[model samples]
Target: MTCLKADLLILAGVICLSLVQRGKTKTPARVMALVMTVLMVAVAFIAVPISSMNTLTAAQDITAKLNPNKLDAEIEKIAEIKPVLLFSPKCPACKEVTEALAKLDPKGEKWQPVQSSGEAQEGVKYLKEKGYAGEVSYHRYAGGVPVLIIKQNGKITTIYGKENIIKAVTAPAK
Candidate 1:
């Protein structure tokens, strides 16, 4: 049944019950009806596609179908690098990391920190969107921002924030 119809029926039921109860059940029934109305409104609003809102959405819709194998493989290849920096401009922790990375490197060898459009999915979406062919690291340890993520053979490790970046830099390579 349509949600609008169902909500209407529920509202009618609540009103009728309140009338029968002579206002004794007025508060409870009215509350239930209000809850139901809000739920219905939420469902309707959430049902609309965020395509218009999501700037990351496809710019042009391609009508022709294409194979995803070549694309996925290439993306996986790039994502398999030992460690990659994922950061967004919106994160303060990322700002700290960026500053440290800038100062820590003389030859630009500390780590390559790439600026992502935003940090959603730890900024992995930016990598894939830009045609990176490897897996996106999703390690939960300090996963928010300024993360040094290493992915190899299905294993993911993460070191979070600026302090860790300094430690990794000062430590000898393994």
Candidate 2:
């Protein structure tokens, strides 16, 4: 995804530079071309990989599989701050959980409902890459959502399904 953005940026910069170069007599145009060149170079250096495109794509595909432990760790971290409820917006069960949590913890203190807004894969990618601790190699999680992870009796407990989530969230803290 990032490489795709970099490639697009480079392409746009090249097009802009070419257009600017066509009018090289103007000082502003020359400056713009130089700026575009520098911008493209910087983006390439920072985002674009030096490896072959196939190699990069293959590597990305390999890394794109979600690491369950990382997902658990991320949820655990969120649970430390507040019990985390991972929900998918489009899911019916998740919707029920969301409503339950909304009514249960209006102040957002008792429960933190993290919306895994998009598809499961995208959600996992978002969580892994830009989660509570950013830049972690979290990948696509093609699993069921509405997962409630909390600390219960000194142990971290993960509850799945809408009924279990509702029960766990509503239960008195021990």
Candidate 3:
């Protein structure tokens, strides 16, 4: 059966149990109420999908931001920090992540955005034209964007964000 139908059946069963208990029991009404409350709470808790829900929500937001045609400029900028951002023009989640990154305004920093294109050679040419000196990496995933890898000289650090990219980018250099 469908999830909606199953939920309706569970609700009906709870109501029936409550009515039957009221008709047949001499038990205190307050005690019965507490038992019903506990059962409802347990059922509600079990109905939630807690583990991967947040990840999926984040991916949804990220997917809405990708723009393949404009990616070369963004990637060149991100490369200044470290040449890496895994992006696919066709992925909804990747688009959303790109939008989030654009909102970061990582200006004056050595960070550049990198988007993967099916036409790798053309993409490389575009990156070079935009002044990106770092190597371009191709990505096939349609979900989360790769972590932003910031490299200064020889040290490298990875970071990820949707809501707090500004805070992360503006924080004092470690």
Candidate 1 backbone overlaps, count: 8
Cα lDDT, all candidates: 0.51, 0.59, 0.50
* lDDT of model 2, residue 22: 42
Best by lDDT: 2
Candidate 3 per-residue lDDT over residues 75-147, each given as its tens digit = 4455455435665544454455555544443232423455555565654554454444545556443334544
Candidate 2 regions with alpha-carbon error over 4 angstroms: 1-67, 70-72, 119-142
In candidate 3, residue 122 scores what lDDT? 54
Better of 1 and 3 by TM-score: 1
Model 1, which residues run further than 4 Å from truth?
1-82, 118-143, 151-154
Worst lDDT 10-window in candidate 2: 130-139
What's each prediction's TM-score?
0.38, 0.45, 0.34
Q: How does model 1 score by TM-score?
A: 0.38
Better of 1 and 2 by lDDT: 2
Per-residue lDDT, model 2, residue 98, is 67
**How much is 99 displaced in model 1, in angstroms?**
0.7
Q: Give the TM-score of candidate 3.
A: 0.34
Segments in model 3 whose C-alpha atoms lie over 4 Å from true places? 1-83, 103-110, 121-146, 151-157, 164-166
lDDT of 2: 0.59
**Candidate 2: clashing pairs of residues:** none
lDDT string for model 2 (95-166, tens) is 666666666665555677676556545433433332222221222344446567687665786677667777
Ranked candidates (lDDT, high to low)? 2, 1, 3
